[model samples]
Target: MSVLVLNTGSSSVKYELIEVESGERLANGVVERIGEDAGRLAHDGGAVEGRFADHEAALRAILDVLGDISPEAVGHRVVHGGEHFREAVLVDEGVIAAVERLAPLAPLHNPVNVIGIRVAQRAFPGVPQVAVFDTAFHHTIPPHAATYAVPPEWKVRRFGFHGTSCAYVAERASALLGSDLSAINLIVLHLGNGASATAVQAGRSVDTSMGLTPMEGLVMGTRSGDVDPGLAGYLARTCGIDADEALTRRSGLLALAGVSDMRTVRQRADEGDEAARLAREVYCHRIRKYVGAYYAVLGRVDAIIFTGGVGEHDAEVRAMSMAGLERLGVVLDPARNQAPSTGERAVSEENGEVAVLVIPTDEEWEIARQTLQSVRRGAPQLGDHA
Candidate 1:
């Protein structure tokens, strides 16, 4: 049996077919710019540059590329499961309805995620579909960490995202450290266009940076993180701006440096652009703060694991973020950090008290694995159709 994983974005769909038994990626591809002119589909080393009117068309195009391949199960990356789901669940009509009801919580992602599930179900009727949530892994977070200080009647609390990536990298980090996962403490820095820091103690998430939603975490590409609560009302009165919209789309590196790409920000900073330099400082400062806070929370730190785009590729960010943390026993080797390498490896000083590592996140593989496990555990064994 094979598992087809679909990570559906508002305008793009990334698909991967994996053989469950061997853990081999049989095929992988993406359809980008859906609903826009000059859309493109690239799959299995081939490219088809054309407009896809909608997700249905994009998915159909993907099926064309897939040709004769048939997956036994499909896993959809549903961004917000709210408090309804703690783990991956078999997709059904009721589940779809529940997800639809929760759309307002993740308006930008849940609707499209539901679209992907519906499309995949149509494409592969009777094939089990599993929903692996980004928030599922963080369900282990303690009450003190997950709870908000607001009134209990409000019913709002932190539901961390990117748990799929965190789960994958935590295990990988444990393997690299040559320690039992249950015995090690870890700090996972997932820094992409969206970023978050998670404190993993004994393989369980004790705390995470993202709160209520993904927009609450570290300085991201366009999202303003940890802004003053009063700022929203102020913006509404003075600027006529919706606080949520401003935070989700107009702040962060884009607002500070005039661009969202970290590489571009770093490049401009290198050229002595003060705004870009300040942006970089703010970004690294936020990460450093979280690292220190998590270290305090854990008491004894085992390793600081870096994953995601910026965390893995930007050595300067990694080093600068941990820069004054020598007292915490978190030290980075300048040479090791700068060396170019794709595989998982430590950038910390040899035999250092704390290990700083770069482990590329593999969310797709994790989703597929979890989907397979759900299916094997008697999660609606639907009959396959040719």
Candidate 2:
């Protein structure tokens, strides 16, 4: 059976059509710059670049390209399900409302994600659409770890993101160790345009870096992670800047080095740019602190896992992030780490206490797999259209 996976962002939609059983991607492409002057959709091994006015039109055109594949199910990567959704849910009017209700919690994600789901529901009416959340797997965190030091009535608590990637990477790390996942302690670092670290104890997420929002953890592409909470009020008063826009947009590596891409930062650092150098140090330092913090939390760690864009592709960041972590049983071998290996594999020294690994994340495959299962296992079986 085939399942179509859609991951819609505020201005972009990434899609993949997969053959569920074999886990092979049948078709995949991205629609970028949606609602902007230069929006485009790249699909069927070709790219079309132009202006896409809204998500509805973008998805409709995407389906038009897919034609009559008759996917068994549709899966969407919903960013924050809060405490409401713990697993993939079959979309209905009720589900849509439920997702929309949580948009305030994920201002940049949920609303746009709802648009994707609604558009899909219209184009492929009745085809079961499932939402697999990025916050679901981290739901295993205990109350203490998930709770914030805020007033109980305020309803603030940690809701970790990038869970699907962590789930897939944690399983892959277990396989490489030749051990049961439940028997080992692992630290998962998911670094991309966004980044966060998760402490997995015996196959469950006991603690993670992100708290309440994606902006509260390790340094990220455009968001400043772990700034003093009061800085918002201070910055607003002193710099006359809106706190939300400042923290979410004009911050993090972008603010530190004037660039969000790590490659560019590294390049400038290579050329002796002091700001770029400090940005790298700050980024790696934040990761190291989480490692130490999680090590204390996990008590014992079997593996230090890295995944996502920067984690898998940038060996330099991996090495620097784990630098001086050897005393805590984390050690990386230069040759193995620098070796051009792909898929999931280890890069740690032979006798290292914590096995450092690179597990390439496959969120689309995970979404497709979960989508098919969500449909067959419990979703009402009506027709392909539904």
lDDT of the candidates, in the order given: 0.88, 0.86
Per-residue lDDT tens digits for candidate 2, residues 110-137, read: 8889988887787778788898999999
The CA-based lDDT of model 1 is what? 0.88
| TM-score of each model, in listed order | 0.91, 0.90
> How many Å off is the CA of 242 in candidate 1?
1.2
Model 2 misplaced regions, further than 4 Å: 10-12, 31-68, 379-386
**CA lDDT, candidate 1, residue 381:** 23
Task: List ranges where model 1 is wrong by over 4 Å.
Answer: 9-12, 30-42, 45-61, 379-386
lDDT of 2: 0.86
Please give, for residues 106-200, the per-residue lDDT of candidate 1 as tens digits.
Answer: 66568889988988888899999999998889999999999998999999889988899999999999899999999999999999877999999
Clashes of each: 0, 6
Measured over all alpha carbons after superposition, the RMSD of each candidate to the real structure, in angstroms, is 3.8, 3.6
